[model samples]
Target: MLEVCVESVAGIGAAVAGGADRIELCAALAVGGLTPPLSLIRQAASAPIATHLLARPRDGNFRYGAGDAALVAQDITTAAEAGLAGVVIGASDASGRLDADMLAGWVAHARAAGQARGRPLSLTLHRAFDLCPDLFEALETAVHLGFDRILTSGGQPRAADALDTLAALVARADGRIIILPGSGIDTSNVAAILRTGAQEVHASCRSPLGEASEAEQRFGFQNGAALQTDPAKVSALKAMVRRA
Candidate 1:
């Protein structure tokens, strides 16, 4: 399946028009991704494609204290109540191991919330898996946590740069969970990334729109340039996945 990670409502339209199989909805894609507001989540719930909210409450490390964990739990519940297909989440310990206890609680919370809504919530372990000291062990932990998938780059900055490790992860997962390779993936290298045996791939599929207004930049409200999802890129990548 082809999953497009989008930061805006326009992106939802693009993903649907481009025939993407799923959407990983988030905000502030510049800092990786942050949890989207409920307004955006509600909009995504109406999307034609399956949509998963990236339930990250912050921009830094994946470690969560009580307040952070509480916010994440609320986001998961919000996504379920909003009728989105799933949630994407992750956590890690000081030693960079998967925080199994925290993750288990979050999974349970998501499941219970989904049950209350009469729909099962899909769970995706996010890239924090790449931060683990042992990725294979981390994969096992995610499986035990009842995650439907783990999004990773084989512990590398780009999936294309870690084909062997990605393949290893797919092999290790062995259908118990999905190994979805993402990061630095585009039409140029998606073919190679998919050769690693991942059944699904994720990407931003974004192209430069333009810089923010001078005032927006002057006030530090804007960064370098702005970008938006490119439906053509999504279609091209999806076609490649089908061919592969």
Candidate 2:
């Protein structure tokens, strides 16, 4: 099952229409990813979605401070209220090691908070796993703490860059958890990524970010710089995944 996790409303629609199994909603993916708007969550749920929330406030590093963690926890609550399926996120130390205690606490908090109403909970430890000191150790921690999946690029710039590592992670996972290989996965190389043994793939498929419409342009929210995303690329990736 290739889960095409996207970050925008347009991407969400495109994926659902294109037959994606899941979606991870976020904002400002230019900075990796951040919590998306509440309205977006509502919009997604209204469309028969299996929406996973991204609990990141900023990018650049996996580690965050106390305040930041609290913000992430709050975002989890928001997502839960919005009827989302789960959250895709991470929290690590400055050395890129899983801060076991912090992660444990976060895991507990998120588990309790997100499923307060008894809905099924899904938690994916995001690409921060790629930055961990040891992939095997990190996998153990996620499994011990009951995460549903671990998303990574095999600790490299892209899947191709770390095919061996991705394979190692998948083998280490060994059915106890899911190793979802993501990052730089597109139509040209999705089959190769699948060959690395990832059960699911992640991608933000949509066109370059541009203004919503003339109305938004008139209101001054339009910007010239288009964000990088394209539905065609997403569908292509899906095709490769299916073929694989």
Candidate 3:
């Protein structure tokens, strides 16, 4: 499955147009991703493809405090109310171990909300798993937490650079959970990434949108680079996934 991470409504259209199997909805793609606005979530829920909200309160580290946890919980509720297919989330303690207590609360919250809506929301353990000291241990923790999948790059900066580790994760998962290889995935290297035996892959599928306006850059509206979801790239990547 081709899970395309998108930051805007236009991206939702592009993903659908390109036949993406799923959408990881978020905001602020430049600094990882942030919680998307309710407006976007509502619209994403209506997309033809399955849309999963990325319930990240902010960028930076995954060590969420009490307040941050509250924010993430609310986002989970919002996504459930919005009729999204699922939520993607993760948290870690200072020592880089999965924060089981914190994650359990969020999972329970999402489950309750989903039950209220008459549909069990799917759960995806985000790349925060990559921060763990031991990935295999972390995988077990996630499965025990009721996560349906884990989005990771084999603890590397990019999945393409860690094919062996990615394969190892797939072997270790043993079908108990999905090992979704993401980060730096595109048509150029998707075939190799698929060799890891991952049933699904995630990518931004972004193409250059030209330079930012001078005023936009000066005012901090635009960061170092400007990009947009490229439907063609998404289509190409989806084709690659099919061939694999």
RMSD each, Å: 0.8, 3.2, 0.8
lDDT for 114 in candidate 2 is 61
lDDT of candidate 3 over 83-137, digit per residue (tens) = 9999999999999999999999999999999999999999999999998999999
Our tally of clashes for model 2 stands at 5
**Which stretches of model 3 miss by more than 4 angstroms?**
none
**After superposition, which runs of candidate 1 have C-alpha atoms over 4 Å from their true positions?**
none
Candidate 1 lDDT score at position 149: 97
**How many collisions per candidate?**
0, 5, 0
lDDT comparing candidate 2 with the true structure? 0.79
* TM-score to true structure, per model: 0.98, 0.88, 0.98
Where does candidate 2 stray beyond 4 Å?
209-225
As for lDDT, the candidate ahead, 1 or 2, is 1
Native-referenced Cα lDDT, model 3: 0.94
lDDT of 1 at 35: 97
